[model samples]
Target chain A: DQQVKQNSPSLSVQEGRISILNCDYTNSMFDYFLWYKKYPAEGPTFLISISSIKDKNEDGRFTVFLNKSAKHLSLHIVPSQPGDSAVYFCAASGGYGNKLVFGAGTILRVKS
Target chain B: EPEVTQTPSHQVTQMGQEVILRCVPISNHLYFYWYRQILGQKVEFLVSFYNNEISEKSEIFDDQFSVERPDGSNFTLKIRSTKLEDSAMYFCASTVQSEKLFFGSGTQLSVL
Candidate 1:
């Protein structure tokens, strides 16, 4: 299903720069949005999340911004490091976190 | 530091064979889920289990797919009959009625 989409297949950024990954969702029933980071052989690790009631949430170097009206959300990482080079996925929760629809994921390459 | 754990990181099976993927969700987590990602595809939800029963499932999770929590520590997904298209990385996740989903390392199933 095309309920959630990450149009960018990949992103490249330099160290000490900001890397933004964008996502869009057509489903309005979703209430929670999250970003997960995945290394080559590991499962996705939760980075940050935003509730529909809030516009932004931040933790450490990661921040998530939600624009309900625009049906979009973005993950911003400040001072990107080479260790952050991995696939980032955007997922949306539809029913109290019971079911999640994920985007195609964007590969972020951070160069030092 | 608790984490979801999955076994048999990779499995190769012939078409029509039955394969069971195993996972151990984080201790005390009440919700369990299975999601799969085919090569170059989005992560699609397969099913969600709560209170020892399936609460939700996706279209891709046809009759051939089943989930069970045989014990307090084990969650398993069984494919009654494998197909070539079933080849993908299957991730098991768990949460406690929240947005943060702790995912397992994933099992790479190759159906030949």
Candidate 2:
């Protein structure tokens, strides 16, 4: 399904810089947006999330911005570190099943 | 912190063989879900289970696929007859209310 899409397949950023990953969704019924980080040979780990009612959510160095009007969402990592290099996936929950729909994922490479 | 656990980190089976992937979700979580990701693809929802029954399933979950919580803490996905396309990483996730899904390390299945 093309409900969620991550147009950029990869992104590179220098350490201590801001890393922004973007995602878009065609389904307006989605109310909750989530970000996940995964390393090679591992499953995705929950990073952060935002609800449609709110514009932003932050935890530690990770932040998520949601623009419901544009059907877009983004994850921002401030002062990115090498440990932050991984595949990041954007997912949405809603639209009938309480099941999550995920994007193809964007690979983030934080260069030290 | 508690984390979801999956067994058989990798499994290689012949085509048409029946395979069962097992998972143990976090204790206190009320909802369970199964997702799969083919090589270089996005994670796709397979099924959601709650209260001893499957609440929802995706179109990808066809006649050959089934899910069960045979016990209080264990959840399992069964493929009656696996095909080459079935090869992928299977992740088990649990959440409290369709929010913040905690996922396991994943079980990689290879159907030959």
Candidate 3:
């Protein structure tokens, strides 16, 4: 149940700064990692994902970096906006199963 | 743009009552899953259904819990006997072939 860990309970960033949210996994077998954003009373929404075969994936203002050796992944949101403020969750799953183990969410507050 | 939808955004039930949470997965997605999160806790996988049968389930999904894709579009989770610990937000997700999932807003089940 503790396979995925997000050590930070919360993170604060300036609107125009880069916000980096990190996640670590104890299970090396996990090959797929995903970042999700959740607002109050809403379910986690998929933001980005990276496969083990690749080290980096980017989508517009968001980029995800994966380190296979260290078993870590991080999400970087550049020029963060106030609308980007939400609880961010990191999830990991591998192989054929769709079962994702999630880390304790980190509340990201982008200050305007 | 197709998104999963859940009914009865909030449900309140007495202890030991039977409560059913409903969800409508994305039209073209072939895999379905159920995950729940307690207040201030990480989301936990409950079960996954495919081909009209359960493909995998977590330990938290005991005999008291059951999932059924009663029709082509609707997936439902039934908890035979609710307990105090069953109060949480239940999310229904679907995917085509990857761990990237489209999740519903969630059903806030309050077991009193």
Candidate 1 DockQ vs. native: 0.78
Any residue pairs clashing in model 1, and if so which? Answer: none
Candidate 2 lDDT (Cα, 0 to 1):
0.93
- Pitting candidate 1 against candidate 3, the one with the higher lDDT is 3
**Per-residue C-alpha lDDT of model 1 across residues B41-82, encoded as one tens digit per residue:** 778889999988889899999999999999799999999999
Error of 3 at A41 (Å): 0.4
Question: What TM-score against the true fold does each predicted structure earn?
Answer: 0.97, 0.97, 0.98
Which regions of candidate 1 fall more than 4 Å away from where they truly are? A95-97
- Model 1 root mean square deviation, Cα atoms: 1.1
For all candidates, state DockQ relative to the true structure.
0.78, 0.62, 0.78
The whole-model lDDT of each prediction reads 0.92, 0.93, 0.94
Write down the TM-score of model 3's second chain: 0.98
Cα displacement (angstroms), candidate 3, residue B111, comes to 0.7
Residues A12-94, model 2: lDDT tens digits: 99999999999999998889999999998898999998989999999999999999889999999998999999999999988
Residues A23-86, model 3: lDDT tens digits: 9999988999999999999989999999999999999999999999999999999989999999
Best by TM-score: 3
lDDT of 3 by residue, B4-109 (tens): 9998899999999999999999998889999999998889999999889999999999999999998799999999999999999999999887788889999999
